[model samples]
Target: MITRLAGPAMHRPKLILVLVGIAFLICGAIGSMATGRLTNGGFVAADSESARVAEILERDYGMSGMQLVFTVESDGGAQAPASAARGREIAERLRGDERIDKIVSPWTDPAMGSMLTSGDGKIGLIIATVLGGENDAPAHAAELADELTGARDGVTVHAGGQAMVWSETGTQTQKDLALAEAIALPLTFLLLMWFLRSAVAAAIPFITGVAAIAGTSAVLYLLTFAVDLSVFALNITTAIGLALAIDYSLLIIGRYREEIANGRDKRRALELAMQRGGRAVAFSGLTVGIALVGMSFFPMDFLRSLAYAGLAVVLMSIVLTLTLVPALLTLLGDRINRKPLREAKPVEQSLLYRIARVVQRRPAVCALPVLLLLVLLGSPIVGVKLGLPDERVLPTSLESRQVGDLLRDRFSGNGLGTVQIIVAAPARDGAVPDLRDYQAALSEVADVRSVTGPAGIFSGGELRAPAGPGTTAADSAYVAVATGLDPYSEAGQRQLDALHAVPEPGATVLFGGFAQQTADSAANIAQGFPYAVVWIAVVTFLLLFLLTGSVVLPLKALVLNVLSLSATFGALVWIFQDGHLGGLGTAATGYTIATIPVLLFCVAFGLSMDYEVFLLARFTEEWEQSDKTRQANDDAVALGIARSGRIVTAAALLMAVIFLGISASGVTMNRMLGLGLALAVLMDATLVRMILVPAFMRLLGTANWWAPARSRGFLEKVALRE
Candidate 1:
């Protein structure tokens, strides 16, 4: 059934495409090195208890600043005070560092007006108030941490607070990102090797994926000039880029192999693949781009930059895979298939195939059963929790975690954390708030412990603190508060609401706390939801129209894609939020993070549509050749189902394996992604791809490809442009 063009139209010019890709690669390399550390516009890592404490001090506490908390430990098991004296020496050293605005260790806390040390004296702390901006933070903090490592033989530095959290998270995040690429690329190579049965073809996609990530990183580095970037951006950028590289290259190579098997010569097979598979790939890339770009609705600068970063890689992935992979195929040709694996091929029909056939036969029976199952998984969304991030990251069995538990139990949620209500411009001469009035109002509220203000600033209709030589009106006031709610508790969320509600007459009020972080994240999602819908719609139509050359076809796919994605998201809400999955315990990332709905959709839509494209591309090809609607439809189901179905199932299983591996890493973010991705992959591979898709197509009949001739011609032109 492979048709060869009789004239010059069959062959493509390969040398030019190769040169273009090389040029892009060279340019991309120079860029990554320059921009690797920029935060890329993520909301500064301020949604934490430390941030909340900072906010409370600036707005409510009548102070100019605050201090951090660190836990410096030693597993060296020293019995004498001399060994413990070494830990004290490290604290003393840190107390004298120049970058340290001030320090509060056992020797210094009395002046800072704080606790000197823990009761046993084994664990000592140094509280430092940094003087410079976030830019100067990592290097300074790292230097400080490195300096402190000397006093004890086996010191385990567990640092938290804004400074240490950002620095350490950045380092660990790089490791995670590397781990993802390290795992994905090798696995892709193994899968490709098994599929193409040749080391060359297998290596080509892996190489292309690496190139795309490398190149995208370069471009992203430059993007940091115009925007902020996250410390975690580098790892995520590489991971996403690598994933997409394999995806697009796999499509092209698969088509090239299919063309060759259908009796076309190597050169002709490359052309057909570059044309057909390239067309599908370009559309798929757009779909992924839309998913990535759609995050712009979120107000968090981190998300905005993250969206751009992901889109950049998807575009680069498409470009490199379509051009470089094809050019490489031109050179490698038949050698790409040189070493086919020698294994017993499974029978054509499988349990998945049988289920698909049943759906094809009865349609509704196939759709209803799986649809219900997804609904059940998503029942956890009702009691969703959201909030500031903290590094209570260790297990309950760990000493630090255990001590924290004891403190919470003894003090009824005693915390270094604080929540603030910032009444903006309150210290201006005419507009200065009455400290007596403000304090009285706040005191009336449940948690108000103390209120401090600027020089001459008043609350409770009077000045709460004596006017001092050290104070200024421009400086914000600080308030201290007692709390019945745990800093991490759902009940604490109400504190955020009250803070935001504080009277700001002729001024502004900001709630800065862990509760506030969660509140803002939730609020951002609530407000941005409509935009997300519009974004998804625009993205879905554009990708679908490009793929099938029919307005109707893309719309139909959109309907199902939405259905499938929502089903998956809904399930996550249920299992994680409702705690319906009893064994998972309190460990889930509380209702999948405020941003996860969008993240999940971006990932799930592209993946779900993956099988759709594979199936529809084959089906459409058969229909066009035969012009007998029923015959072509049957051939597509039989052949398309026969060919792509196996690959889809295989890819899903592999993807599941990778996700499951990360799930074992014990990071909350990774675990959520693992569950969501694993669910999406499995469902798309079987229920959506095997059952719902075929059922819908069977119901659509000839109308599935109903584009006016002019439109089809337009699509053909579009394909050429692609």
Candidate 2:
């Protein structure tokens, strides 16, 4: 297949270049508009109890939970005439806004004034419900946050809550993406020039990287019209696209240069390069693409959006690597080797060849220590705790983070920690009695400070006040239960579980709050995790089996990759959750973001398999060309490592540099992703590929190439050949 495609590319290189240039221009224009179409929130599970309660609150009760929180502070204290007047002014401004569905403030509702004000009486709270769903609420909150946050009439007001946090997070992520590109691209170019040893050769990979990013963006732009995509997908696609494009381009160009140096003419050399390098790239891309498809097993749009973006970028990189890169190499010919930076090392004398020889001599001695070290590095993963992101994920310099700190430290029970309960009870004779009992039961749950409903305030299983203004309707009841625990803490999760366990009076009841939402999101991801893992493992095993024509080799590759990924997860827990790496400029949030591990596994696993396929292709090719003896297997392992090690090392270093640039982000989740990927790639290249693979293959001997007789026929039919 590559042979047929290489003919036209060699025959009309100029035409191919012109057509690719035109396509890039079109894609660049379309891709520039993609960010505007993306959304800021996909963290909540759409079918969870929290989401159902939110929907019912909006549709049946004509109200939604508090979407915005403002901390109003004055030096003169809460009851001072001037402070009271300023608080009323802020509430009045919000009350007139069309975007606000409901407002609760000490100034507006004196019935709950004591609960709304701080214990010291110098700070007060104002909470409002925005008039939209997840996507629209953040936009509305941003506008209100901009206009209302600042000093007014001598009272300082700061805006926060989930909606405002999402808004600020989206804006900050865009800035960080730009910063990451600025840092990664130029550094990558210099490294490429050093590795390729020529300006013209380096430019080819750089150009392909740009094309991959732009083309994926154009595809994502089109996808947004059909499905809702998260803004977070943009950062991931950009980094992965650039890294894979350059990696594939390096493989093809390196092989093309080797062929030319062996005295082959331009046309024949291009054919062999396309046959060998091009085939490996095809398998590598397919492996990575299949691994990313595992994300589709998850129900959240966030993971699915990432899957779409990842698949698009992988396809774009493969197409450009197979077509445009080969055409450019065809045009350059002998000139591709001009302006040498350094001399190339012979494969027999390479460092990887020497290591492979040492390992082959004492395979068990070499393998056991490395295995122990990896297991030790991975020990921290057993303690990993998962939760949804909140204001703590952002930098402390941000307004939302500051407000969250203040609320947690200085305030009492308020909207920030309130648990909203919606009960579906029709207007019936004995409804009030059942509701009273239910509220009393809820109030008795551990961590409950108070519960407010039509039965008024309930504490310690007793009523303390009359019914509030908007707690009841003819057919439904809205209850607010306040607690003092941090919503993302383990205790808070237990609190959520306990609340759900309490018996309800109504036939249907839904819980909606920050704690409940976080719990539900984590639960949803956990439920989907097993299915995703099965899909990734089964499909990856089949693909590797087809590639190698050996059942044992594929299984060995899967085991090594999983071990490498476990170490990566442990590092994430150590750095981000346990707060050991202060230099990364992110505070330890005490729990990993629920999506980070899953996202990292899918992406990094595919990438690990990418390098695995590259090395295995060379190994299989060398083994098939020699005798099938044990000594021949040893020679094949050494030769394959020596031959493919340079490409793998160069690609891993380049990819690591890009990911480390992304690690500089202020958001903890982005930082975790960036640093974890960097660790995974570097570790896979050096430890797994260089050390463990040679040791394992030497230990296994010729069994590495063994397969069943019946499966051999099927493997022959579908096997990838270089």
Question: lDDT value for candidate 2?
Answer: 0.85
- For residues 618-700, write the lDDT of model 2, one tens digit per residue: 99989999999999999999999887887789999999998888888887888889988899999999999888999999999
Q: Report how far residue 74 has shifted in candidate 1, in Å.
A: 11
What are the models' TM-scores? 0.80, 0.96
Error of 2 at 286 (Å): 1.2
**C-alpha displacement of 594 in model 2, angstroms?**
0.5
All candidates' lDDT scores? 0.59, 0.85
Over the stretch 1-722, how does candidate 1's per-residue lDDT look in tens digits?
11222112224525545565676677666754643366412442355443554545544443322233455545432223554566457666766666666555544444322233343444555566654445565457666666554434555544444555455555555556557666666776787787667798787777777687668778677777777766545655665566667766777777777777677888777778877777667666777777677777777776777788778778778767756776677667778776342232432455554655666778777678866776665554455565544433323433334444434443333335456555445445535454445545554455544344433333344455564343223534444443445656665666545644666545544556556666667677677668977887876776666656667777877777776776777776666555557514334434446666756777667666766666666666666677657546654565566666655665566555555444433334454555676677677777777777777766666677777777866787774232
- What lDDT does candidate 2 reach at residue 121? 91
**Residue pairs with backbone atoms closer than 3 Å in model 2 (clashes):** none
Stretches of candidate 2 exceeding 4 Å from the true structure? 1-7, 339-345, 425-433, 469-476
Worst 10 residues of 2 by lDDT: 425-434
